[model samples]
Target: MIRNKYVLYFFRIIVGGVFIWAGVLKIIDPLGFAQSIANYRLFPAWMAFFLALVIPWIELICGVLLILGLFPRTSALVLSLFLFAFIVLIWISILRGLDIDCGCFGSFSRRVDYTLILVDGILFGMSTILFLSSVRKKV
Candidate 1:
């Protein structure tokens, strides 16, 4: 991971912007997001609904925090973990022969595919860099 402050800031902006956009979309239509989550068939309906309520808020907050450079490491860590989980889930859905949207960008989601994995992986990498850079600053 690159530890350069400038590069980290770039990543912060990119990743934060992505999450902010995603969160805003989901926030606009909670039921739609819930339905999207349920499409994955991984969670019970109630759980999906509840998660739709909470996940977008978390994404928005963390994205804002990352952009503002406030609690950046924690924010990056949270986003990174989310990215990892998303990657795994995407892979699982693909392997299981389920053609579904990722439910990542609310109404704008694309079909589950290798490209989704690449995008999530790239975001994961960026989040990791931002997190490690923050850690290096503290130490």
Candidate 2:
């Protein structure tokens, strides 16, 4: 049990770090991020612009909170939800044969594909585990 806890914490830190870095990068280049979001052609221009502003902040805050072990359950829940959304969006992009950068990590992003889906899946799994563990601990 103790070993499992340590492993969970490690996963939390890694996942948190990735999100924080990715979010901060996107925040620094909101316009670029907005362009990336628009590439999916899933939202109106204004909606994509607004999301570009807000979503990165959400990711940054939740990610930092997760790393600091503050509001772990809430943070994990938010992160998991974001990951699930990303998974769906990425899948759609793949099905549509849109070969574009995921814009997940700002300028450092890669082309969206099954591999990106796998990465998001791992992050989602980690976030889910953290959320469940935090909830269990609270109870």
- Per-candidate TM equals 0.97, 0.96
15-89 in candidate 2: lDDT tens per residue? 899899999999999999999999999999999999999999999999999999999999999999999999999
Best by lDDT: 1
Q: Write the per-residue lDDT of candidate 1 for residues 61-92, one digit (tens) a residue.
A: 99999999999889999999999999999999
Report model 1's TM-score to 2 decimal places.
0.97
**Residue 43 lDDT in candidate 2:** 94
**In model 1, what is the error at residue 71, expressed in angstroms?**
0.5
- Score each candidate by Cα lDDT: 0.93, 0.93
Name model 2 segments beyond 4 Å from true.
1-3
Worst 10 residues of 1 by lDDT: 1-10
